[model samples]
Target: MHLRRERSRKLIETFKASLTSFACEACGVDMEAIYGPLGAGYIEAHHRIPVAQLEPGQTTRLADLAAVCANCHRILHRNGLMSVEDLAAHLRARRGWPLAAEPRPEDWQGPDKG
Candidate 1:
């Protein structure tokens, strides 16, 4: 029974992970472009909020994640990142995509901070 429950938990996580890894939640770009960027794009899956910050017993939604290139993921999460929504919104606007109809919040200072 204990092992069964553990398997269930892992399966759930795997399903959620799969849902987010196929696309770049940040730019809506396909994972291929977000990852290796060429012959074989190899994107990585990122949890929007760090697992350490999650409330006890809480599981993050797959939509709250992103599939990004290794470098971008490192830049976005070198320290601790809250979420990439703001940066995503900015990129959206720059790309001329239909941006959020509401205002966007400021992104927290991340690894680039000195």
Candidate 2:
């Protein structure tokens, strides 16, 4: 499995700006963009299913990834672990932000999904 963790540049910036401008889905508090070890205001866009776990020839889609914060990301991948969706739902429920309903799951263009 490739361990290289790379992020889409434009997507990273957009996510940071979105998080900053938007309130936290879990706390309703404004959150600032957190940088990865690389120093960019981004964590990592994670797929609920790892690429290594997918069928051959499968590639990641833009909508397939979630812009999770560091703690959520850690909880996701820790212990060989849980699905990103589970973490997302936990975060959503924790903050009581709209993550499902009203906005279609596929139509989620950002935090409005709550």
Candidate 3:
């Protein structure tokens, strides 16, 4: 169990380090752009595949994560783990913006499917 925890921690660290910018993927809110130095690297990491949904022995990859702001993160969970793309579309629809092309179902599946 310790090894599992260590691996999870390292994976999350690597995922965060891989981010070039801390912009919310769903809302496009760049923390640094809004709060300047204070928010330079302040975006939250959200699991595209909720951690609880992972089957035993399933592994997560960087692509399974999404960079999001506090508001969008909360909203995502509040709406029952809605996909990042779905939330973005919902927001765009509310603003009457043209919806982005839908992703294929396969696009939603993360790697390491068992």
Q: Give the root-mean-square deviation of each candidate in angstroms.
A: 9.9, 9.5, 11.5
State the TM-score for model 2. Answer: 0.47
Candidate 2 segments whose C-alpha is farther than 4 A from its true place: 1-41, 91-114
Cα-based TM-score, every candidate: 0.48, 0.47, 0.76
Q: After superposition, how far is residue 25 of candidate 1 from its true place, in Å?
A: 1.0
- State the lDDT of candidate 2 residue by residue for 1-114, as single tens digits: 332235344544555555432322222222232222343443455565676676766655556566555555676678476766565576567656575222223332355432
Worst 10 residues of 1 by lDDT: 100-109
**Candidate 2 residue pairs in backbone clash:** 26-95, 98-114, 99-114
| Tens digit per residue, CA lDDT, model 1, 29-89 | 5434323446243456677666566776776665655665455567577645635676567
lDDT of each: 0.54, 0.48, 0.75
Better of 1 and 2 by TM-score: 1
Q: Model 2: which ten-residue window has the lowest total lDDT?
A: 26-35
Predicted candidate 3 versus true structure: per-residue lDDT over 15-92, tens digit per residue: 889988676777666665556689899978788987767899998788998888899999999988899999888876
Best of the candidates, TM-score: 3
